[model samples]
Target: MYVIYLRKSRKDSDLEALGIDVLKRHEETLLELARARSLPIGAIYREVVSGDSIDARPEMVRLLSEVESGIWEGVLVMEVERLARGDTIDQGRVQRAFFYSNTLIVTPGKTYNPAIENDNEYFEFSLFMSRREYATIKRRMQAGRIRSVKDGYYVGNIAPYGWRRVKADDCKHFTLVPDEKENPVLKLMYDFMGNKKYGFQKTCSALTGMGIVSRSGKPFNPATVKTIISNPVNIGMLRWNYRKSQKAIVNGKIATSRPKADDYILAKGKHPGCISEDLYYRANSVNSSMTAPVKRSCRIQNPFAGIVRCSCCGRVMVRKKMSAKQPRDYLICQYAGCATVAIELDELENAVLEWIRNYIADYKVNNFESADDSEQESLRSILVNLEKEKETTLKQRGSLFDLLEQGIYTKEIFFERSTALEDKIKDFDKKIESVNADIVRLDLSKKNRSTFVPKCQELLNAWDTFDAADKNTALKNVIERIDFTKTEKNARGQRHSSFSIDVFPRISR
Candidate 1:
């Protein structure tokens, strides 16, 4: 008995001709073909959506599981991709599922038998072409999104909560605008977090107490609450790739670095904001501490208090006690004959603060280049060229394969040439990936350097006068450690002192 299968992709081209009705037509045609060949038909398996991913369509999944149970003699389909659209990985799954159950896959164009030697190459080539098509589709989709963003349209799945799409004044397009009724929740959240000085959990509880639900109108989980607070769109700006997985597309089936920050289009006042920029920034500063509530409530102590080392291994000395009656703690470095000696924590803190202040002052007066727009543009150009080169190499590889298959070259020559081509392709692919990674890193560095560097300097300059909590936060943000080492030396020997700093803003705090 044969099982007729069908699938439609997300593309309008696929949907227009091969939607539900078209699948029904294919079913009718399969029945006619079956009758003409005197083949017994048992059941039909149909998927209304694309099979770019195996898990995307439930019907296809059910069919594959049933096929593996040896419930069908064959899977008849209109085309190979209809059974498994877009990629070899997906097609391989369907091929294996049917083959393991001793079933054949019969397409209108080609009937593939897994056991045949010559047929293996054909199936492999077909699957490879499917994957290539998938990649092409992904490139096109990304390019479209880039263009759409440039055109200033919100190109996401759904508008943020408390916002609704409405026709722009031009009437040619739609824009997101604040929903009058729903926006109140945003204001409330901002007030609780900012003015009320409530912790995240407290704010969540307060919302629930007030009978207020999340954007989804359900109990708010910590993740959801965090996401709401962190989303820049609510504060009249938009940031992409905040959730890394959102950058992936099913057609590619691989994680890729999202578009750079420079690519994000900003439309100011395009929609009424739920919270002001100052309030949002203030809220972020208030929530900067990553400590849990339990730690905040308890008397927190660090076991590795002074064990951490700095660039110089001078033993971190501490003052034993203030006096005969009072207890005191002070960090110092005691390296004999070394210029470094036991200095009061207060004194050392003052020195570090002076050094940081001088550093910032020098940095400012030197007219240091923060980030130039032209640099971002240049990086984008480099990435675009690399992508173009990758595409060209893929097409050339395809042509070489065609030539090999057409007997334009002998097997020995074809094998040697193809091997070299594959090596070149792999090298180019690696280079492309490397370039993309560099671009992502550069973008992130530029963003952080611009937004946080000034803040860093400001905190450092005020470190000496900062409150205990602020001092701790500043120290945690900047210094990795202050090490101390001791050494025996001749009496009254002169000493040299040296220290180094490695600033890693991203990973430090």
Candidate 2:
């Protein structure tokens, strides 16, 4: 039996320009090739995923797994490169799987039997050539994008909300044009922030009430409103490279990170301003001033400043000094005419800490009978698999060096292959470390009540020694909010208050 595999690479601009019809033609071509070769097609695997990496393609992974079962005599594709154009590890995996299964790779150009030494080398060379081609194309595209950015043209597909894109006279670059509908909403947002002094939530609510939707055609959220207000594009300026971004595939999804601020290029864009520069600055300045911390000479740090909320008005409680002589702080509700009682900082901290200590003690007692043994077992299994993968990668690296020494591989190919394998080994090492950490955490969780009790006690002791910042972090981690009611004076003239504390422990119950 044989399987026919078809893949469409999004990086091929020519193929994309031809539309969905081209994909049908590609499949027909492969099918005709298989029919002419008298190969039996058991199944067909097709996907439209970019890049050569198997991580991005579910069908490729299924095909490789099926091939490994030795159920298929071979896989038929248009060309050898269709199997893989990824890094060395993926290329090696495909080759080795076919070699071990004694399957042939059938292409219109030739049939490659991985068990044959010459055929195996030819297949590897094809994959290497494909990888080089992919790298070159990627580099060219990235260079073009950077050049476009430097030329004051929009390189991205979608323009910011409230803007439309029009091709420049060159027909290769894009310029932003104001969207008559969204641009008015954008100006209204600036007006709300600067002139009306409406905060993000209030502005979002007002926009939603006015039936103004975001780019997704959904009611405007605070985040969407804030992005429009904060963006510099509204002022007819283009800002690029404000932050350095790195992309990685995590659990089959592309995750991006902007680690730190980098050098930024700001240029006047070829677009009319939706809002004046003065309005933009004024709006942002007002937002910053409203959010600034209360001034103090000694910089008094209150752990529960923002977390505490009024039980009556459900508004955030603000920190205020009780008296100049007392030197004590209290969290008071800022809502007008709210009778919610003020909470002394010391009293609130003591009450929260005591509750946490008791909660941890009770959790330890209750969970002592039910350990996370299943999680530990799962971690052990993952660690074993990771170790095996690491060993296989190391062996492959050593084999590559042997091939280099035997003059079977040129220095350039040898270095490229070795570097790729080293990267795989590094990724495996990271996974192993992460698994080990999980196992350790599970082990601690499964410890006896006596052992667990001491850990909780140590945590309590650590709180006493923590600085104001650390204390604040600890409070935020364990307690969600502390609500207070008005204090009452007893017949004996003693003041008493009640609190409703919302505790959210870090550990699961």
In terms of lDDT, which candidate is strongest?
2
Native-to-model Cα distance after best TM-score fit, residue 249 in candidate 2, in Å? 11
For model 1, how does the per-residue alpha-carbon lDDT over 191-304 read when each residue is reduced to its tens digit? 877787766656766777777776655655444555577677786665543443333565855554533354445544345567888888766555521222223355423211
Off by over 4 Å in 2: 35-43, 51-53, 61-73, 89-103, 169-172, 196-202, 208-213, 217-223, 241-244, 247-256, 259-261, 289-355, 360-453, 468-509
Q: Per-residue error at 420 for model 1, in Å?
A: 72
Give the alpha carbon lDDT tens digit for every residue of 304-331 in model 2.
7567777777767666555665467776
RMSD after Cα superposition, model 1: 22.7
Per-candidate local distance difference test: 0.61, 0.75
